[model samples]
Target chain A: MGQEHILKSHDNELARLTDEIVRMGEIAIEQLREAMVALQRRDATSAESVIARDVDIDELERVVSEDVVQLALHGPMARDLREILAALRIASAIERVGDYAANVAKRSVALGFTPPPPQARGLGPLAEIAIEMLEQVLQAYRDRDADVAAAVRARDAELDALYTALFRELLTYMAEDPRMISSSIHLLFVAKNIERIGDHATNIAENIWYVVHGEAPRQERTKLDRTSGG
Target chain B: MGQEHILKSHDNELARLTDEIVRMGEIAIEQLREAMVALQRRDATSAESVIARDVDIDELERVVSEDVVQLALHGPMARDLREILAALRIASAIERVGDYAANVAKRSVALGFTPPPPQARGLGPLAEIAIEMLEQVLQAYRDRDADVAAAVRARDAELDALYTALFRELLTYMAEDPRMISSSIHLLFVAKNIERIGDHATNIAENIWYVVHGEAPRQERTKLDRTSGG
Candidate 1:
């Protein structure tokens, strides 16, 4: 093949790789949303399904890695190479997010079998913040919008704050009724899994910024006292 | 330059990258050990230093990325390319391990200021398990030993089991005495952070297996009922 034809084919291949990653990102987001739904409704069947679907995300990550191998073999330019690396990073982050979702799903199954405490009320909103962060960060990847990614990164604190409130509330519940201890501990881990999902979304947003700018953003990541209250 | 000379230079660059990564891994392991010691002694000064040193790990990650870009720009063959990619993956995982250590350190500071609960006894062994995993995984990376890596991966379950035991112990403490509730929760998070550090070490072990085998390990990662009692 001529040089021009080969270059054009590389471009097409990169586009295909991008499409696959975006599809994988969508699946991960669906998994997060579905896990939250399962938790809210205490639906074990739905949570089980979400947990099962993580295999699909894991498979898609393998596919993306294979594509990365193919692209690197073709000797892409520096800009394209960095973009590929960023895609790989983002894919790994999204897969971890899927794992966190499955963790939440597993927690939902556990919660379904047991009686929940009254303080379980705040969990839905805590999960919503995480899901929304996942949504925004995935959108940031699709649009290559660093500003949107920054916005998603900043909003992680909201999840932290909500988690803090839930932490305090759950401790009080456990203290008030010793019988609530086991279930409250389970609920605490579920809250922690959701909070970690938010952290993964921020990781993805940082990858997005890296993809767009070819380096990490200059701002230091905001660190909050996540273990204390939120 | 002759083709042979260029190939040799590439090998040198790759070796340099690998050495840097090993150094970074050593620093991360030290951080984990220091954090655990600080927690055990309730030494706020030592914990503060661990948190402060995470910046060094972050800087090392940036250095690794720059080296990856430089190596990739040279258009090395597929084997060399995959090795470069694995180095990047391992570097990121170690940085995250450092972050987990810093998190443990932060928890140490919190636990130090607060009165301790008696159940805090279990945390020492839990952190020890996590530190052992980190040490073993880094050795796996240095040796490029897939067997060692797989062994490290399997040992994560031990940490999980310890964490589950700790979780139950702390819950019982909180249930019996309301006064122990606050510090118990902090201890709970410290245990969780140590468990997470073990997870990161497993991640690095997987990366090592990938780098050695040129694909993910064939074994499905061992899963245990981590949330329940041992």
Candidate 2:
């Protein structure tokens, strides 16, 4: 085999890996959005579908790991190595998104028959915001636009503020409406999990920015609060 | 350098990695157990101390990663290489345990001045069991004992059983006494987070067994409930 032939095949491999991860990311984002819709409408069928499809996302994640190992052993040319490593990491984030999607679906079913609590109202806006962020973050990631990715991460502060207010308000609701407490607490957890998914999405955006620009984003972004009771 | 120097240094590096991860895991277990005590006693200072120490665990995690990359690049001798990778994965789990310790402390403060909830009785036993599992699982990991690790994971089923019964009792208490709602929910999240720490410990034990045997352990004694919300 001549040098140019080997080089051409390696470039083709890079293009394939990049395309595959983007496809996987799109599926994850779509499932996350759909999972919320299922919850809002009490659509168990759609929720079940999301749960079933998560295994496919898991399989895709496994394949990406295999590809990375193969690339390392076969030895990517200098220009292609960075792209492969970046895609591998992004695939992991996408896989996590799929897990969260499955989680949301599970919660939707568990709480579906329970009467809606006041805290459920808070989750509506939070979900809307996270879905929007997931959409833009995926686009920014696919474009490798560090500037746009950074902007998406900055948007997380809004979710944090919303979650904080909701936490306090829910605490008050639990105190006032004892009958509604169990369902309300479940809603609190579901909303918190969705917010965490947003955090994970922001983490991926930062990782993409880092992959493009050679440094992780700042440490000052709304980190996990140390006092849950406070 | 002679083959002997190369081999000796490789062995020393592997030992260092293992020792560092073991220390990290032990510290995290201490932090977790202490945070639970702080919560039970309503001792905010102890909780604050646990939160303050989390940064050290975070720093040690970074050092562990760098060591893995160095060993990979420098070509650690064959036996040492496998041990280093196993230690690397275990170190990641240990760092997460540290995060959960901080989480427990934060929940302690969030719980505030409310009289302890009735459902919290379950947490006492769960804590005792988790403390035992943490010690046993870490021992299994360090000693590379598959049987001990398998038994440790088997105990997670009991944790789950305790959690389910605790959650139901908490719900019942809230239904009967609306005033206890907020504190009950706080304890619920704390209980859930501690159970998750047990899950991570089980993961480390499984990895240790894999490192020794070159294959996944046979199916665990039992799996977490897929039907119920975790």
Candidate 3:
């Protein structure tokens, strides 16, 4: 093959890989949306569907892993090497995001068995923030814009603050009314799942920054979740 | 350099990579142990130490990533390629294990503010199983023993069952005594951190199986943690 042909094919492969990752991120976001809808509507059937779809994200992750191996064997330059590494790490982060979404769905199913508590209202805002972070980070990754990625990283503290507040609220609610304890516990985990999705989004943001700059992000991540300390 | 000398140097690099991973695993285990002890003693000072030391595992992971990149650039054979992939994944998994240990420590610091609940005793047994699984999986990784790795994988179900039991028990405790609600919630997260550590160990075990067999383990993992479903 001609040298031009080789470079063209490599670029095409890189484009395809990027497309697959973007598609995976979209599906993960869909899963989170469906999960939140399931939670809000108390629809176990929708929750089950969301859980079933998690495998799609996992399968895409496997495909991305194989493509990374192929690209590595082609012996690209250092910049491309960073791209390959970032792709691997970012795919893994997205996979975990899907898992957390499924976890939220699973908790929604459990929550369905009981009367929805007033505090369940708190989850909607939390999921909204997390989903926004996921969307923004995926866009930053696609654009290779470190500035947008940094913005996503900064937004994680907002998610953490919401989570901590919800956590304390659930504890007080459960303590006031023992009947809400079981369902509140499930909500607690659901909130935690969403918070962790935000963390994964932050992870993706950092990977994007690394791919663009060939170094870790300059600023340290500031975590505001104080439930553990409270 | 002679061809034989080049091969010898490649082998040495591989050896160094393996040694670095093993050391990382050891530090992760130590962190878990120290976190557990810190929880049992309700010593925030010791817990603080465990949290501070998590950076060590993160640093080791960065080193492993660079080494993997260097090894990949050397044009490894197919088997060595699998080893490189597995090493990258194993390092990431161990880093997460370290993070969970730190999380456990953070929760312990919070728990120290309250009177020690009886539920705290349950965490010790859970941590023991998680630590054992981590140690066994690291050994399997070092020896490249798929059977041992599979055995470690099987043990995760035990950890899940223990975690589920603890989950139910803590919930019941909180419901019966509203005063224990805050402390029980912290214990819930602590148990979760240990359970997640077990899951990371399973991840490492699967990576070892992949390194040895060049494929994912054939048996589907059975998750026994039904707290989400319950």
Q: Which candidate number maximizes DockQ?
A: 3
Better of 1 and 2 by TM-score: 1
Q: What is the TM-score of chain B in candidate 2?
A: 0.91
Q: How far in Å is the alpha carbon of A5 misplaced in model 3? A: 3.7
Runs of candidate 2 exceeding 4 Å displacement: A1-18, A69-91, A115-119, A212-215, A223-229, B1-8, B76-88, B115-119, B213-215, B218-230
| CAPRI-style class, candidate 2 | acceptable
Query: What stretches of model 1 exceed 4 Å from their correct place?
Result: A1-4, A224-226, B228-230
Per-residue lDDT tens digits for candidate 3, residues B18-72, read 8899899999999999998988889899999999999989988987987787787
lDDT of 2 by residue, B90-163 (tens): 77778888988888888887774766555666787877777788788778876778889888888888887777
Cα error of candidate 3 at position A85, Å: 1.6
| TM-score-based ranking | 3, 1, 2
Q: How well is candidate 1 docked (DockQ)?
A: 0.40
lDDT of 1 by residue, B60-97 (tens): 88778767866876746657656766787788888998
Note the Cα lDDT for every prediction shown.
0.81, 0.74, 0.89
Error of 2 at A55 (Å): 3.0
TM-score of each: 0.92, 0.85, 0.97
lDDT of 2 by residue, A116-220 (tens): 554677777887888788878878876788888888888888887788778778778877877667667666777777777788779778767766876667666
Candidate 1 per-residue lDDT over residues A65-161, each given as its tens digit: 7577667666466577567667878888888888888887888788786765567789889888888888788778878899999999999888888
Model 3: per-residue Cα lDDT over A1-230, one tens digit each: 99878878888888788888989999999999999999989999999999999988988898797788678777476478688888989999999999999998999898886776788899999999998999899889888899999999999999999899999899889989999898888899999999999999999999999998988998889899999864
The residue ranges of model 3 lying beyond 4 angstroms of the native Cα positions read A2-4, B2-4
